[model samples]
Target chain A: MTSSFTRLLVMVQKELLELVRSLKLLWVPLVFVLLGVMQPASMYYMPLILEKAGNITEGAVIEIPQPLGSEVLAQTLQQFGTLGLLVLVLVGMSSVSGERNSGAASLILVKPIAVFSFTASKWTALLLLAWGSLSAGYLASWYYTGLLFGDVQASKVLGSLLVFGLWLSFAMTLTLFFSTLLRSSAAAAFSTLGTAAALSLLAGLLPKKLGWLPGSLSSFAYQTAVSDIANVSLFGWALACTFTLMAAALTGASWLLRRSSAID
Target chain B: MYDNFDFGQILPIIAPILTIQLVLVIIALVMCIKAEQTRGPKWMWVLIILFVNLIGPITFFIFGRRNER
Candidate 1:
C-alpha cells in the first residue's frame, strides 16, 4: 500500500511537470482570470458601452439598473460554467487518449507503474488545474465586484466557489473518462461537452425534479452567492452526486486504461 | 451621464481587463507562430486571434494546434 501511494505521488509529479512544460499551467488560469474580470467589468460599464457603441442621441435615457455585487459574482460563475468549462474540457480531453494514440501510454505502461496510479495521477493534475483556475477566477471576480459594486459576504463567496468548483470537477472528470474510453481526443471532447450541455438543459427545464443532479451544481452556486437563502438540502444532494460521479469516472477510466494497455 | 465618460475614471476600471485580454492575445499569437503546425491555415488563425476578441484567441489556443507536445 505504501509503495502504491508513493507510486501515485511520483506519477502526479510527472503529470504536473508535463502540465508546466506544456504551459497549460499558465494559460488556462490566465484565461479564467480574464473571463472572471470580464463579467463585472462589462456589467459595470454596460451603459457606457451601449452609449458609445449604439450612438444613442444625447439626452436619450437608458435605465439599466446596477447589478448587486453578488449578482456580478454569480454572472462570473456563469461565464466559468460555459466558456471556462469548454476550455478546461478542451485542455483535458487529450489527457489519456492523446498519449495512447501517440503511443506514449504504451511506453509508460510497460514500466512497473500501476494503471490505477496513472489514471489517478492524470485526474489529480486535471483537478489541480481546474480547481486552481476556478478559485483564481472566482476570487478575481469577487474582488472586482466588490470594488465596482458592493460587498458580498466572504462566506457566501467561499460557498459558491466550492459548489462551482464541484461542477467543473464533474466536467473535467467526464472529459478524462471519455479520453480513456475513446481513441480520438476530438470525439471525447465533443461527447463530454454534449453530455454536459444536455444535463444542464435538463436541470434547467426540470429544476424541481432534477435539483439534485450534478448539472444543477452551477445553479446551486449561483443561488448561494446571490441569495441569502438557498435550498441546502438540494445543494447537499448535488454535492454528494457530483463527488460520487467523479469517483466513479476516475475508477472507470482506470479500468478502461488497464484494458487498453493490456491490449497494446 | 455623457460627461461621465471621463477617460481618467474609466481607464482605471477598464485597464486591467484590456491588459489581461492583450496578454491572452499576445500569448496565443506567440504560440501560434512558434507552433510547428496548426489545425487550419496559419494566416487564418492570426486573423482570428487578432480580430475575434476573447473567444477567438481562446479558440486558437484550444483547437488551433495539431501537435501540442
Candidate 2:
C-alpha cells in the first residue's frame, strides 16, 4: 500500500504533464468558464431581450430579476453540472489509455514504476485538472453574476461551488478507472459519459434521495444558494469525493491485476 | 467571481489551487514531451491531441496505446 501510494503520487505527476501539454486542457477550462459565465448573463439579459421583442400577447409578463446571487449560482451550475462534468469525464478518460497507446505506460513501468502507481497517478492528475476547471467555471459564474445582479452577495454561492467541485472531482475518478479498463480512449469516454448519464437517470427515476449520486451535488448546491438549506458540511462532501476517487483507483488496480494474470 | 482578483476574499482560495495546477500542468507537459510513440503515429497523434484536447487523448489512449512498439 505504501509503495502503491508512492507510485500513485508519481503517476499523478506524470499524468498531469500529459494533460497540461495537450490542447484539451486549454479548451476544457475555457469551455467551462464560458459555460458558467453564459448561464447568468443569458438569464439576466433574457427578460430585456424578451421585452424588446414585444412578442407577448395580452397576458402577464414574466420578469427575470437582474441575476440574484442564487440565480447566478443556479444558472451556472445548471450548465456546468452537465456540460462541464461531461468535459471533465472526457479529459480523464485519456489519463491512462493515452499513455498506454503512446507506449509511455511501458516506459514508465520499465522505470521501477508499478502499473498500479501509473494508474493512480493518472487518476489523480485527471481529477486535479477537472477540479481546477470546475473552480474556474465557478469563479467566472460568480463574477458574471456579481456584475449582472448587484443585489446578492458572494457568500450566497459558496456552498454550491464547494459541493459541485467535489462532485466533479468524484466523477473524474470514475472516468479514469474506466479508461484503464477500456482498450481505447473513445470507448472509455463514451462509457464514462454513458455511466454519468445513467447515474443521472437513475437519480431521477429513484424518487428518494440518492446521496452522493450525480445530481445530488447540483441539488445541494442550488438549494444552499436559494433556500435556507444549510450548506452541506464539508466533511460529508469530502468523504464522498474521497470515496469515489479511491473507488476509481482501486478499480484500475483490479483491472491491472486482471490483465497481468491473463497475460501470465 | 467576487471581484476581479479580490485579493482579500478570492486570492486565498485561488492562490493554492493555481499553484497546484501550474505545477501539475508543467509536469504533465514534460511527461507528454518525453513520452515515446511510433513514428507515424506519434506525430499524427501529437497534432490530433493538440487540437482535440481531452477528446484526442481519450481516443488515442483507449485505441492507440498498444500499437506502439
Candidate 3:
C-alpha cells in the first residue's frame, strides 16, 4: 500500500514536470489572468470604447450602468466557465491518450505501479493544474474587481470560488476519462465539451428537478456571489453530486486504462 | 467625450494585461523558432503567433508543437 502511494506521488511529479516542460504551467494561468482582467477592465471602459467606435452618430450619448463588484466578479466566473473551461479541457485532452499513442503507456505499464496509481496520479496533476489556474485567475479578478468596483465580502467570494472550482474539476475529470477511453485527443475534447453542454442544458431547462446536478454549479456560484445564501441544502446536494460524478469518472478512467492499456 | 477622458489614466489600469500578452507572445515566438518539428510550416506559426493577439500563442502552444515530450 505504501509503495503504491509512493508510485502515485512519483507519477504526479512526472505529470507536473511535463506541464512545466510543455509551458502549460506558465501560459494557462496567464491566459486565465488575462481573461479575468479583461472582464472588469472592459466593463469599466465600455462607455469609452463605445464612444471611440466609428458607428456612433454625432451628439448621441451611450449610457452604460456600472456593474456592482459582485456582479462583475460573477461575470468573471462566467468567462471562466466558457473560455477558461475550454482552455483547461484542451490542455488536458491528451493526458492518457498522448502517452498511449507514443507507446509510452506500455513502457510505463511494465513497471510495478498499479493502473489505479497511474490514473489517480494523472487526475491529481490535472486537478492541481486546474485548481491552481482557477485560484490565480479568480484572485486576480477579485483584486481587480475590488479595485475598480466596490469590494465584495470575502466569505462570498471564497464560497463561490470553491463551487466554481468543483465545476472545472468535473470538466477536467471528464477530459481525463475520455482521453483514457479514446485514442484521438480531439475526440476526447469534443465529447467532454458536448457532455458538459448537454448536462448544463438539461439542468437549466429542469432546474426544479435537476438542480442538484453539477451543471447547476455555476449558477449556484453566481447565486453565492450576487445574493445572500438562501438554499444551502440545494448547494450541498449539488456539491455532493459533483463529487460523486468526479469519483465515478476517475474510476471509469482507471478501469478503461486497466482493460486496454495499449489501444493504439 | 475626448475633452474629459484621459488616455494616460487607462494605461496603468491595462498595463498588466499588456505585459502578460507581451510575455506570452515572446515566449511562443521563441518556442516556435526553437522547435525542431512543428505541425505545420514554422514560418506560418511564427506569423500566427505574432499576429493573433491572445489566441495566437495559445493556438501555437496547443496545436503547433508536434514533438512533445
How accurately is candidate 2 docked according to DockQ?
A: 0.06
Per-residue lDDT of model 2, residues A25-113, tens digit only = 66567667666766766575476557656588755567554545676677678788777776677556666666677766666666766
- In order of appearance, the predictions have TM-scores of 0.94, 0.68, 0.97
For residues B1-69, what per-residue lDDT tens digits would candidate 2 score against the true structure? 111433465344344434544443443344345667533456666665556644454445333443333
Candidate 3 or 2, higher lDDT: 3
Score each candidate by Cα lDDT: 0.89, 0.62, 0.90
DockQ of each: 0.65, 0.06, 0.72
* Candidate 3 C-alpha error for residue A212, in Å: 1.0
How many angstroms is the interface RMSD of candidate 2? Answer: 9.1
Residue A31's lDDT within candidate 3 is 92
Q: Find the candidate with the highest TM-score and give its number.
A: 3
Residue B50's C-alpha lDDT in candidate 3? 91
Q: How do the residues A233-258 of candidate 1 rate in per-residue lDDT, one tens digit apiece?
A: 77778778888998998899998888
Q: What value of lDDT does candidate 3 attain over all alpha carbons?
A: 0.90
Could you report the Cα RMSD, in angstroms, for every candidate shown? 1.9, 8.5, 1.3
Q: For every candidate, how close is chain A to the native chain A in TM-score?
A: 0.97, 0.80, 0.97
Q: After superposition, how far is residue A203 of candidate 1 from its true place, in Å?
A: 1.9
